[model samples]
Target: MFKKLLSSIGIGSATVDTKLTKAQYVQGETVEGVVDIRGGNVEQHIDEIYLALVTTYIREIDDKKFEEKAVLARYKVSDSLTIGPNETKTIPFQFALPYDVPVTVGTSRVWLQTGLDIKMALDPQDRDYLAIEPHPLVEAFLEAVRQLGFRLRHVQCEQAPRYWQRRLPFVQEFEFKPVSGPFKGRLDELEAIFFVSEHGVEVILEIDRKARGFAGLLSEALDMDETLVRFTYGPSDVASLPQRLANAIGRHS
Candidate 1:
């Protein structure tokens, strides 16, 4: 009775740890991993095992910064099972990564979280930080942007607008302020949003042009939308991407 009581209170309950085949994965690749669990002082019945991919982002409200977590993907990896005292068990799992999972850029991050569900005892969890890399098309596009003399300033994921057809609820923004370019003094900043697929990459760029004179305040008063430029790229365009992107922004800015 004492041992069961102690175990229920998590004094000697089961614990869990997750191991992955690798620490980094491409956004669309499959993630292969195993959850290793060990039973405690008393025999216990575990209801299930859960796994999720999570990331943190900053939200500013009233001059205060609040950190919030975005759960990108999740799954139930295992069913009910029983373990004897001091026994160990392992559950293996494999799942396809979400298409729009945010790649780790600057301070933004992504990771795997594993947890065991049991009735009275506290749930044991394990967290493993993982890196998500951009697709080749996205990598080349960002490189081309940098080549056009834009300084990468900040990156964030914001709520998707009504018309944004995204698998996830949020969209990532890669903000760049021009340092030395024809558009340097003419714009406020340039933000790049990506929708990646197996065949091609779609980009939506928000051109925040510098507000001027009375037009600036009038624009604000009228709730005018920022200029958005949309385009797509594939393997064939790598050679001309830099010039193509520069001209597009120039024309719209």
Candidate 2:
């Protein structure tokens, strides 16, 4: 009776802990880990195990700030199980992170949420923050953008609207503003949105340029009509990337 009461209140319930091979991983790579479950003060029947990739971001509407969670991926680890008291069970798992997953760059973050569902008790869970880095080509492209005098301003992952055609439910935006060269005063900001995959990368650059002429007058007054440019690249383009980036951003004819 005491064991049942304690289990009902979660004192003698099953506990879950997830262990990953490393703290850092590259986008689109596989993460190998194990979900370890240990029986508490009494033996318990385990129903299911769930693991989720999660991240949080801030959104502003009017004068209010809302913190929201984006579930990148979720999966089941086990079906049914019975454990003896003081026994430890390990379930191995491998998750392939989506290529477009928001990396732990600047203020952005990604992590895993693990849950153990007890048959007649509250579910116990765990969370582990992961360090996700951009792929090699993506990193090179970002470096090229930096060499072009665009200083990174902000980076955040937000819920992607339908038009973006994102693989995951959300998308990350890396915003930059010019600090030197021809685009300095003429451009307001340049935002980079990446659509990454195992094969290559697609970049969408949203150029917020200062308007010019009479049309500039109307644009400045209306606050609309930014420019969008898209490009696809592979590892071979790394060497001449800066020049290509400069040309794409209209730095030269």
Candidate 3:
């Protein structure tokens, strides 16, 4: 009775630990892992086991910025089970990583949160950080930008507009500045947003052009100094990205 009472209040409750097959993964890849549960002083009934892919994003409300954690995906690995005292159990699981999951860059992060649901008791939880690499086409696009002499300035995930929020509530934005090449003196900065799918990646570029003269200053004051360009790229277009991006920027600039 004492053990059950202690366990009910989480004093001697089961603990959970998750072990992933790998610590790093590319977006859209299958993630495989095992959840280990160790029982404590008394037997416990676990209602369910779940894994959640989570990350944080900044959102603004009434001019105040708030950082909120978002669940990118969730997977139920197991159903009901009874864990005996001091007994150990391992539950293996595999889930497809969401393509739109933010790549672990700058202040952005991704992690797997594992939890065991227990009735009338504190649930055991575990968190494991993951290094997420961009998809191949995304890698190619970023490389193309680098080749054009644009250096990565910042990266962040922010709340997306209603129209832009499809699978998740936020979108990851990559900011770049021209350090060399043709765009050095002509452009101010570039912001890129990627919408990735199984077929291709759609990129939205916000081209911020430098104010040139009195007219340019007036245009900037009127918020007319930025241009939005949208395009999509597939696997076959990898080799021509440099030239294509240059042409697009040139046309708008």
Candidate 4:
């Protein structure tokens, strides 16, 4: 089940419209958009008008799986007010995306949604969709990985859950393949998790080691040990990727 809450007074409901200014953005970039609301046929006393920034996540609990739960970024776009019949209002919003905003490759399933709740007699809902594109720097980084002979296996968007942090509602994980040379023989699989924030991006990498008893998926290895590494990146530039990845590998070694 998805998470939601709504409360509307006894009058009429209001309609909501949301528009995003750009289809493409970077990890550390800002998103510009607007929310427009129109009154319905009857006058309504609205307790509050607000917009929420939400991302979908996949979660497993007690061996059960769920998808596309809403995450709240902010509230309070407007206070309590009464809108007369057939009235229209507009609100502008600027959202600062975290530096670790996950990169989407191909036609992945992800959404940036604006949800509005109108307090008429009870709360009614309105929603709008926006197109999200990879930032230039993020695309460059992926290109670099491709240059390094890595293939993207799968990519997904998920929420952090209550265990990690109060504010970190969403996270993205990318699985990749290293099919040649030294890495193929020693590593079974590589997974990258991105944690984006205001200041910079935190990259958590987990490489599954080839199990000794059984030859691992990517390569065959005997007496091997698994290793984990963390890397930090910012500015969303192409030039920084090689150096940063190299530095992280070196530190792990």
Candidate 5:
């Protein structure tokens, strides 16, 4: 109990605090935050202050499945800042967020956050997860999906592997509830994978079809067991994603 008690008493340790100006921000928007450093008993000189956006990436390596949390983006916030014993220093920074960012659950499902990485001399990297909000355009696109009768399933983020020549390490796939009613027996599941760039969002709809037992057996024998339909949604967007997806599949089929 005494050792545990002393661990919480600062006990010759240094700490840093990071605070963001806002919890919500849009893509291409500048994010403002402050890094406050508190020194302990002795003086210390920091080599550099850095911030990075970390994301998880899933891929298959050597026929084995694995997931990696990669540093998507990084920026140097400060070069050198010294602090005396028991001294405090505050440094403010502004950074532009990537146009394509993963949407995680937050306040009213509106806030977004990315992990921050800070490296100090002779200490473990000081990391922080800062929350942010979606941009208007991103929110609008999500609303369109909801309007199309698809419920949110889950969001999975992964980095595109070498096999994926897409030049993107991080990919966010948003799974949706299956289109029900008449379509319930037709399709297995639906997913909307968004690849956002500076210009707009690249929406890809993946439809998994449920096959009959006989047909399934035949396809499996032929080494083709599943059917996946892929399509792209563009800037001139449609209000209903399900309807649009149906049309796209129809035209392609």
Candidate 6:
């Protein structure tokens, strides 16, 4: 009776730890791992074991900005089980990582959260940081941008407009500045948002043209100097990204 009372209050309860097959993964790949549960001083009934892929994003409301955690994807590993005292059980699981998960760049982060649900006792939880890399085609596109002499300046995940938000609540934005290319003197900066999936990559470019004389300055004041361009490319189009991207920017610059 005493043990049961203590367990209910979480003094001596089952614990859960998750082990991933690898520490780094590219977006859209399957993540395989095992949930290891060790029983405590008394038997306990676990209602469910689950895993969540989580990341943080900046959200603004009424001119106030705050950071919030977002769950990208979740999966249930087991339904129900009884763990005996001092017994250990390992449950293996595999789930596809969402392509929209933020890559680990700048202040952006991705982590896997594991939890075990109990009826009365506190839930056992574990967290593991995941290094998420850009997809291959996305990587190639970024390299192409660099080859065009745009230096990556900053990266962040923030709230997206309703029209831009799809499966995820926020979008990751990458900012670049022209350093030594044809656009160096013609443009001010470039901001890019990438939406990646199994089919292809959709890129949104906000080209900020440098303000010039009276008319250009007036347009800047009205926030009209920026042009929004969106395009989609797939694996087959990787080789032509440099020329295509140059044309896309040159048209607006």
Best candidate per TM-score, number?
3
lDDT of all predictions, in order shown? 0.86, 0.84, 0.94, 0.59, 0.58, 0.93
Compared with the true structure, what per-residue lDDT tens digits does model 2 show for residues 1-253? 8988888788867788999999899888899999999888888888789899998766666768777887888888899888788899999999788787787987798889998878678888899999999988889888997887889889988666678856565678899989987678788889988988777889988888777789876976886747778999988888998988888888421
Over 1-253, each residue of candidate 6 has an lDDT whose tens digit, in order, gives 9999898888888989999999999999999989999999999999999998899999999999999999988899999999999999999999998889888999999999999999988888999999999989789988998999999899999999999999888999999999998899889999999999899999999999999999999999999999999999998999999999999999998
Ranking by TM-score: 3, 6, 2, 1, 5, 4
Give candidate 5's TM-score. Answer: 0.74
TM-score of each: 0.88, 0.90, 0.98, 0.72, 0.74, 0.98
Tens-place lDDT per residue, model 3, 1-253, is 9999889888899999999999999999999989999999999999999999999999999999999999988899999999999999999999999999999999999999999999999888999999999999999999999999999999999999998788888999999999999999889999999999999999999999889999988988999999999999999999999999999998877
Error of 4 at 133 (Å): 3.9
Instruction: Find the number of clashing residue pairs for candidate 5.
Output: 6
Model 1, span 1-253: residue lDDT tens: 9999998888898999999999898889999988999999999999999998898766666768777888988889999999889899988999988778888887778988998889988888899998889888888988897888888899887666669946766788899998887878777889999998888899999888776779875775675536889999889998999999989988976
For model 2, where is the 10-residue window of minimal lDDT? 244-253
lDDT of 3 at 118: 96
lDDT of 4 at 228: 69
Which is superior by TM-score, 3 or 6? 3
Candidate 1 Cα RMSD (Å): 2.7
The ten-residue window of minimal lDDT in model 1 covers 217-226
State which candidate has the highest lDDT: 3
C-alpha lDDT (0 to 100) for residue 116 of candidate 5: 21
Which scores better on lDDT, 1 or 3? 3
Compared with the true structure, model 2 gives a TM-score of 0.90
Off by over 4 Å in 6: none
